[model samples]
Target: MIAEMAHLDVVVPPEIVDNETSGETTVEEGNSVTLTCKARGYPMPVVSWRREDNLKIVLRDQGNKKVTVTEGDQLRLTRVKRSDMGPYLCIAKNGIPPSVSKRIMLRVNFAPVLEVPVHMIGSPLGKEVTVRCKVESSPRAVATWRKEPGEQMIISSHKYNVTEYKEGFYVTQMSLTIRNFTLEDAITYRCVASNSLGATASSVQVYEIQPQKTRTSTKNDGDDSRLGNQIPLAASDHDKNDLDDFYNELDDPINNYLDPYHPGGILDNDRDREPLLKDPDIPKSPTGSKTFPYLNGGGGEGAVGIGSRWWWWAWVVVVVFWSVVLPGRVAF
Candidate 1:
């Protein structure tokens, strides 16, 4: 007898239900929003919610706990902000060979906000200057430059240039450049931003400032002569007289003071000069010993002292007399 085959159920892959699930949603800031995702599959598929960018999802209901993936068919957000605007993913899986996911975009609308980087700008005359402001809003804002007091609208022209740069989906950089800045351009300018939600404005003031000055240094002839005339501390009166004599000798060409063969030249004068040992300028000590003036620091005199040579001559004569007379006596 053959047993009957057990009943078997067919396995099925997960499929997202588009009609029963939420699609693209738009809400204002500080408001609450809900996204629902439903799916059908065998073995009951599990539904999960996550950000398309893989960023943590904020849960306001559970004390603002942030989580990467939340298990449910519904994703609820309270007091939504502009940062919460992006694509979200709803995934469905049941341990099947194929899983399914749906993309839902969230857009949060907000009023136009303006931020001025510099409130006051100073520029030199006849030069160009640029002033910039930052704008943040949803549904791109119409930005403009307006001069205060008169409320005159400024447009791109030869005298002024208006520019805009989109830094992000909700951030724009607005700039106004003034060519050949002059006194007329020195005034309070306002940056105005308006959108479908609201409008905002900020101000910038331009003023004329003096250009930086460069300094130069110069030397005077009198100052140079004064510095040259100042004498050194170690120079003595004798040194000054010698320097003067040298200059005088140079002026008198007839003297030929530097000539080696001349009668009155440096060589002849040095040869005829009295020796320091025999000179009477050196003073005698209390013991009758000749003392050197420069060595003792007692006098700033003509030259360094040389003691007497009488003792040297006496020794030479004594040796000669002893050798001659004693040798003669021994021979006799």
Candidate 2:
């Protein structure tokens, strides 16, 4: 072993082979897909896979258990789902100064799905209201608004405003606005979505709410009697005291001065007596007329008048004279 020293060991960073790896792939839902990543280095590079968004990878072969990283040069997905549609990253490293990564995009196609946020919407008459529906699909579905019962397509105009908003790569919000909503517009409307995969529809009901009616009450002659009867039900203590004072004043002898024929003297007969003052306990009618209590009845009907009591006493005296005094004279 005479002369020269030979070098055998070498180190190299990992580099992904572009021709052997997958960049972007599109497949239908429920189909199988495979992603391959090949890398080379002085020492054999270890290959691993992960999601570009750092989300977990679902392993269908391993009882659908989720994992952050999978060790393999080839990623196999059987029976792909829509949730598997996203960007994936393949990493290669073997104790190298810089690791290598390859981005692979996965797309899964599915049928159109329709969702109605509010199935029933109410708007006041001559007001504006909007009906909304959400759609999710790959390949960008075509959305349309159609009035039910006839399936007439809605066009963008002053009466009906149709609009679409993009919420995500595959999610869109569809809306139909009705200006000056009326009774005729209160019907079921359909939101239809169609794509190359499939077509779907959802319904929304629009209803017109009548404007609230305002009621006002006024004092009228026709309602005077009913209203007068209700006053006693709500009478307060102060009103009762005022009524008592009024009745006492009516009973005073000084009020007899108002009678021209019986001034300062007692009434000779009940027929000649009359009420000289209005009763204060009774309520006045809406027509500015006062109500009075009954004069001849008592014990719940009304208070008895002074003239009615006098009449009863005079009748008793006459009966006694006819039965006792005249009968005794004739017998003697």
Candidate 3:
């Protein structure tokens, strides 16, 4: 029993740490990169990623102008650039002592690419037209069609209509149908295709209508007579002038009160009632001189009576007076 007096010591194994985790596993130039410091410990250890030289782990991409960083006991590099790439340390501590973690790597990839294509189809009156717009891209695209002048295109029940299709990654189609087309049916059509990157448009197609036949009628003697009968008898040139003069007199306040025949009797009543003058050789006065009896009242071309033979000098007096004084304001 004296052999049990000696004492012995036993060694224990280190506890397993947290699963490795990297903050912002992927990053872009001019973007902030955050590395997560997740570690395991018996009492939950504190974790952090630090630069070896104790210098800031930040890098500036002047060209891209971005920053990068991380959370959870990790280092954040803001506006990250190619220069920011280097070994980083992760430290963990449960108060027993601080422990560092393995470094994590982050890589950034470029964005997706996209493109579109323009397409067109022509149409005419009373006809159907087809058009297709195409799109090509790294991630595929979408295409659509609509009428220009107005949003919706009305298809006639009689014969025309439209059909649309969007299927494969590369192509799309739209069809326009026109029935019993008339000149009014002519119009321009357009198509459009687009993707995440950009959009494109097709050219306008103008529709033209065909011409139609027409008939015209000819005139005959009997037809002419019938038309003549249809016209009112009082619508003759003389009647027209009389009516016009009546209306003219109404409009002229200064002459409205004047009698159609007497017109204020500026000339004798016999001279005033005379008909319109006609071209004739000037008659010599009874006194045989060009200097005939001058009438004082003014107005031009009057005779003594409608049918009576009167001295031409009497009318000459009126003509000369009208020419000299009435031009400024011919009341009627």
Which one is best on lDDT? 1
In candidate 3, position 89 carries an lDDT of 64
Ranking of candidates on TM-score, top first: 1, 2, 3
lDDT comparing candidate 3 with the true structure: 0.48
Instruction: Please report how far candidate 2 places residue 299 from its true position, in Å.
Output: 34
What is the TM-score (0 to 1) of candidate 3?
0.24
lDDT of 2: 0.81
Give the alpha-carbon lDDT of every model: 0.83, 0.81, 0.48
Global Cα RMSD, each model:
12.2, 14.0, 22.2
Sort order, lDDT high to low: 1, 2, 3
Worst 10 residues of 1 by lDDT: 252-261
**How many angstroms is residue 120 displaced in model 1 relative to the true structure, after the best TM-score fit?**
1.3
lDDT tens digits by residue: candidate 3, 68-139: 322356555676654454456666666554445565555532222222233333345566544334433222
Winning candidate number (TM-score): 1
Better of 1 and 3 by TM-score: 1
